[model samples]
Target: MASDSSADVVIVGTGVVGCLVAERALDAGLSVLMLEAGPRVDRWRIVENYRNLPPSMRLFHWDAPYPPKPWAPHLETRVAKESEQYLQLEGPNARAYLQGYVRYAGGATWHWAGICWRLTPEDMRLKSLYGVGRDWPFGHDVLEPYYTAAEYAIGVCGPSDPALQWPPNAERSKPYPMGPIPFGPGETRLTEAAARIGMMNLPAPQARNSGVSYHGRPPCCGNNNCFPVCPIAAKYDAATALPKIEAKGGKILANAVVYRVETGEKNAVEAVHYFDPNKVSHRVTAKLFVIACNGIETPKLLLLSKDDRNSNGVANSSDQVGRNMMDQPKLFAEVELAEPLWTGVGPVQSSSILNTTQGEFRNRYAGAMFRMENFARSPLGSAAALKKGLVGKALDTEIRRLSACTARLTVEHEPLPLPINRLTLSSKTDWLGINKPNIYYDVSDYVRRSAKEYTVPRLQQLASELGATSFQLSPEFLNSDHIMGGCIMGSEAATAVVDADCRAHDHQNLFLPGGGAMPSGTASNSTLTMAALALKAADAITAQLKHG
Candidate 1:
C-alpha cells in the first residue's frame, strides 16, 4: 500500500467536468488533485492513432483512437464482445445505451461534436410546463451565468445575433467568445432547403475556435476530423486543461483507478481508495470530494462504495443514486440528395434545427433537436462502391457521386428521467475486480411516440425538401452518448441523489456534478449542460470550503 496523499479538494475524474471544477478550485487558491483511471497521453499520440486506423473504422469508431487501459476499461465499440467486457446492458433498448466514450485522461470531450446547447426555460420546468418529466429545482435563469462562464472557459464560438441563438430568448449574460464558423456548401444548401419548409437552420454554438484564437489554442483549420481526435487543438478538450491546471499548481494522478469512496462521521467522505495497474492500493484524503466521472461511472462508483454505515452504497440513502438513467435517444435518416451538397468543409457539426426542440407537443410526447451531419461521406461511399466490385473509372465515379450526393440527418429526442431506466452494479468484474456498469435502458414511449408521431414526419419533410431520391430512417433508437440523470437532482432529498448545487444529500463534503445531476435533457448534446453544472458546483464548493 502507498502512503496517503492529501489536498483541499479531490476530483475523481479528469474529464471536462472534473477539469472545470479543478480549474475553478485552483483559481480560488484551493490545492486540487485530480485522479484519472486512464493513462495520460499527448494529443499527437491520439492523432497518430486516428491516422493509422482503417478507413472503415474512421467514421463510427469515435473512441478507437484512445485505447482503454486494462485496469480502467471502457467500451471498445468496434468489437461488440470486447465492449461487453466493460459496460453490460439489458432491457428492450439496451443497445440504445451502448455509450461510445473514451476512458482516457480527457474523457468524452476528446471525441464530441462540441455543440453547446443551453436548455430553454421551459426545458427546466418540464413537469410545470408539460407534466411529463421531473422539473429542475432551479430554473434556466439560475444557470444562465454559469452557461456563459462555461462557454467562455471552453472557448465557445457562436453567432452574436440573437436570432441565430438556440432558444433565442435565453437571456445570455454575455456574447460568444468568438464568431460563428460559416456554413459549408452542404450546410448552406440544407439551410436554404430547410428554410423553404418553415424550419430555421440556426448556427450551433461550438467550442472550436472560429477565426482568431481566444484561449491559447489555435483557430480551427477545418480538418474535418473533430471526432476520434482533433489533430490540431482547434477544438476544446479536457486534455488541453491538464497543462493549464498543472501550471496553476494542481496535481493530476493518471492511471489511478479510484474504486472506493470512504466515508466517516456524519457520512462525509473521508478518503478515496484507488488501485494501480499492478493492483497496489493507495489512499488520498481531501477536505471535499467531487466525483465528476461521467453519468455512468459516477453512479457506478457510488454503488461500489458500500460500507457498514452505508450498506446501500454511499449517497444511496434515497436509493436513487444509480436510477433515472437518461440520454437523447436518437433516430437517424440517411438521404440521397439530387444535388452535390458536398459536406465536410468545417467542423463535423456546426448547425442544427433547434426550433423542433420547443413546442406545445411536449404534453403528449418528447420534443427533438435535428441536425444534418457534417461528417464527410467519402469513406462510407468508397466502402459501398467497393462492395459492388466496381473497378477503375466506374468505381471512382460511384464513390464521388455517393459522397457528394448523400447526407445524414439525425433527430435527438428529449428523454424523461424515469426511475425504471436505471444503472446497477453487475456481477461481472473487470480486470481490477471492480463490478462492471450494468444498465437497463428503455428509451420509453415518450421518445418512441415522439419519433413515430412528431420527429419522423419532420425528418421526412426535410428529406423531401432536400430532393431525396432515397431516404432510410433507422428502425431502432440509437445512443447519442450524452448520458445523464443517473444521480438525478431535485429539491427533496428523499427522491433525488444530488441537490441543485450537485451536492450529494447523504454527504455534505461530497459533490457529484455534471450530467448525472441534471434533471432534464432538452434534446441536445448534454456536454455544455454538464460543464455549466460543473461550474455551478465549483462555486458552491468554493463557498463551502471558504466558509466551513
Candidate 2:
C-alpha cells in the first residue's frame, strides 16, 4: 500500500459530525485530514438540478437532485433496478429502513431539513426509566454542555421563551445563538389547535441563521427550498464548511472511499486504506481515526475491514459493530382542512408537538414526536387535480383549494435498539468490488405498539382539531431518516461497540461518534445528538494527542 500521506487526526466521512470534529481538531492546532467517499459539487449546481428535475421527482424525492457517483453509490429508491442497489434491505420492516441519505461530500445534510432536537434526560435512561431499550453510558447532564457546543457550532436558531422549548425548563448552558423563525399560517393555526388540546407546538431548534448572517453564511430567505439544496447558503450543511475547513489548514480529499481500517499493536487503529475514483488504492496513516459515516455506512465499513488480528472486524470483539440498526419509524396522515392553512410559506419544517415525546406510558411502548409537514402541498394538489383530468378555471380553483386546505401530519416514534436489527456485509459488491451493506430491520413491537395504540389516536385527534373534512392515514410505517444505533454505546464492553466518549471499546484510537453510537433513538431528530457526540469525541481526541 502506498502510504503517501499522514495527519494528526484522520476523519472518515465529511458529514456534519465529521466536519464538526475536523473544525474542533483544527481549532486545537492539530493537523486534520478528512476523506469523503463521494464527489463534491457546488451548491448552485444542486439548486439548478432541482429546478430542472421532473415535477414528480422534485416533489418528495429529496435525493433526486444530486445524482450519486458510481463508486460511492447510495440507495436510489426511485430507480427501477433493485439489483443495482447498494443497500440490500430485508426483514418485515425493511422498507422502513430505506434511508434517504446520500454519499456525497456533505453527506445527508445536503438535503436535511436542519431540525435540531435535544433528547430529554429521561431519553438517555430508557432501560432504567422505561424498562426498554439500552441506557446511555452517561447521563444527559454529561452530554448537555456538548449539546450547547454543537448548537453554537452549527449556528442553531430557536425560541428564547422557555415555554416554547421542548422539555420546557430543560437546563441549558447557554441560550441559542439566534431567536426562532416566525411560523407560517399553517403552523400558527396548528399551534393554536395544539394549545386547545393541552399540548405545545414548539418551534423546532434549527441549524440555520435567523434573519442575519451567521458563521459567514446568509440567513434563510423563506424560499421553502431547504431540502435537496438551500438556494442560498442559509442552512448549515457540512459542504459549506469545506472551504472554511481548508482555510483553517485542514485537508479534505474528496472521492476517496476509505474501505479498510488497518489496526496494529494493542488493537489501535494505525491507518485506513481508500480507493480513488479510478480504483487505485492509497493508505493514510494517522495517530487517531474518527468514523462519522452516519449509521449504516459507519457500521458497514467496520464490518468490511476484517483482519487476522481482529477476525470479526476491528472493534467487533463483542460481535456488536453492525447490530442494533435504527431509525425513527414514521407514519403519515394527509388531512384536508375546512379552513385554508396556507403552508409552505417558509422552511419545510419549523415546529413540532414535543410534549408527546415523554411520558410514563414510555414504560409500555415508545413515545413520539408529532409535526405538521410544512412542505408546500401545491405540487401534490396540482398533480392530483391534473390526474382528475380537470382544466381551465375549474382546475385552477381545485388546485388552489386543495393546496391551501391540505396538510401532512407526521408521527415519529422512538425506537428500541434490537439485536435482530442489523447490518452486515453482503455478497453483493459495488463498482470498486467492496461488499454492499445488507440490513435486516424490524421497527420492533416497541415502535409498533406506540403507533397502533398511542400515536395513531393522537394523529386523529389533531386532524379533528384542524377541522378536517377528510383524512387518510398511511397503512405502513415510513423512514424518518434519523438513523441511529448501529454501533451502540454503553458502559459495558460486552454489549456495546463504543464507550461513553464514543471511542471504540476494543480500539483506543478508533472513535465512532454519530448516530451509529447512540444507545437510544429519542423521538426527535438525532442529528443534534450526533453532533454533540462528535464534539465530545473531538475533546477526547485532543486530550489523547496532547497527553498520550
Candidate 3:
C-alpha cells in the first residue's frame, strides 16, 4: 500500500452534486480531491457507442454508452441476466424498483432529462401540515437561495412570467439565467387539450441553453436526443463542469473505488481506502469529507464501512443509514389519438399539468405530476410493426401512422418514506470481491391508493379529452429514477442520518448531501433539490473552515 495521501477536503463521486461542492470548496481556497469510481469518458466516445448499438437496443438502452466497469458495477437494465447479478431485490414491488444509473466519471447526470423542479413549502412540511411523511429539518425558504445558486451553476432556462413558472408561488431572487425554451407543436397541442378539462399545463424549467450561449455552452438545436446522450453539449451534465473544477486546481482520481472510511480520535473520519482497477489499494486523508454519491450508493458505502467503535457502520449510530428508501412511483398511458397530434418535435419533455401536485386531500392520498412524453415514436413504432410480421410498404406505412398518432402520457406519484423499504449489503460479491447491494422496496399503500382512486381515473379522462380510440394504462408501477431518502435528514438524531445542513450527526466533519439526504420525495425530479442541498452544505463547510 502507498503512504497515506492528504488534502484539505475530499469528495467521493463526481456527479453534479459532487462537482458543485468541489467547485465551492476550491473557490474558498481549499485544496480539494475528488474520487470517482468509474473511468473518465468523453462525449465523442459516448456518441459513437450510441450509434453502434443494435436497432433492437437503441430504443431504451440509455446506459449502454457508459458501460459499467468490472470493479465498479452499476445496475445494467438492458440485459436481464446481467442486471440480476448486481442487485438482489425482494418485496411486493421489487421488480418496479430497478434503477438505471451510470457509475462513469460524471455519474448518472449524463443521461438525465434535465427537468429541474423545486419543492413547494408544503412539500417540506408534510408531516406537520398533512399528517404524512416526515418533515424536512427546515422549510423551503431556507433552501430557496441555494436553489437559485444551483440553477445558475447548472445554467437553467425557464419562464420569467409568474403564470408560466412552476410552483407558481415559489420565492425567486431573480429571473432564470436564460429564457424558457419555446414550446414545440406537440407541447402546444397537449397544453390546449389539457385546458379543456380545467387543468393548466406549465412550461418545465430545464437545465439547457435556450437562445444565446451561457457558460460557454451553445443553445439547444432541438435534435430531441436528450436521453442516452446529447450529441451536442447544449444540455448541462456534470462532465461539462469537471473541466472547470480542474481548471481551478482541484484534483480528480478516476477508477478509484472507495471501500472503507477510517475513523480516528473522537470517531472523526481520518482517511478512506480505495482500490484501483489493478486491485492496488491506497489511502487518502482529508480534514473534511463529503459523500455526494446518489441515494443508493451513498448509504451502501456507509453501511460497508464498519469499524470497532461503529460496528454497524461509520455513520450508522442511529441505524438509519440504509433505511427510508423512496422514489416516485410512475405509471404510463399509451393512447392512439383519433387525429394526428404529431407528438415528437422538441425535447423529450417540455410541459406538464401541475394541478394534482398538491392539495388538502394529501392527508388521505399521495399527489402526482403528469406530463406528455415527447420521445420520438419512430423507433418504438417500428419495433411494434416488425413484431406484427408486417414488411416493406406495410411496415413503413404502419410506422408512419403510429409515429404521428400515438402519444405517451406519464404520471409520477410521491411516495412516503417507509423504513421497511430499505437497502442492505447482499452476501453476493462483485468482481472486486465487494458485497452487492440488496434492496427491499414497496410503493406502499400511500402511492397505490392514489393510483387506483385518483391518478388512474384522471389519466383515462385526459385520454378521452384527446379523442383516443385506443388507450391502455400500464398495470404495474415503474421507477422514475429519482432515488432518494437513504441517509435522510432530520432534526432528531434518533431517526435521521444528517442535519439541516447535510452534516452527519455522528461525524461532524463528514457531510452526505444529495438525494439520499432528502426527507421527502415531492412528485418531481429530485436533481434540483439535491443540488440545493449540496450548496447549503458547501456554505456550512466554508464557514467552519473560516472560524478555524
Q: Write the per-residue lDDT of candidate 3 for residues 221-327, one digit (tens) a residue.
A: 88787888777878899999899989998888899999888899999999988999999999999989999878888888998999998898978888989898889
The root-mean-square deviation over C-alpha atoms between each candidate and the true structure, in angstroms, is: 1.6, 1.6, 1.8
TM-score of 1: 0.98
Could you tell me which 10 consecutive residues in candidate 2 have the lowest summed lDDT?
A: 75-84
Q: How much is the lDDT of residue 123 in candidate 1?
A: 90
RMSD, candidate 2, Å: 1.6
Winner by TM-score between candidate 3 and candidate 1: 1
Off by over 4 Å in 1: 1-4
Q: Residue 33 in model 2: shift from native, Å?
A: 0.7
TM-score of each: 0.98, 0.98, 0.97
Query: In model 2, where do residues sit more than 4 Å from their true spots?
Result: 1-4, 80-84
Candidates arranged by TM-score, highest first: 1, 2, 3
Residue pairs with backbone overlap in model 3:
none
lDDT of 1 by residue, 186-300 (tens): 9999899999988899898999999998779999999999897788888999989899999998999999999999999888999999999999999999999999889999999
Model 3 regions lying over 4 Å from their true place: 1-4, 388-394
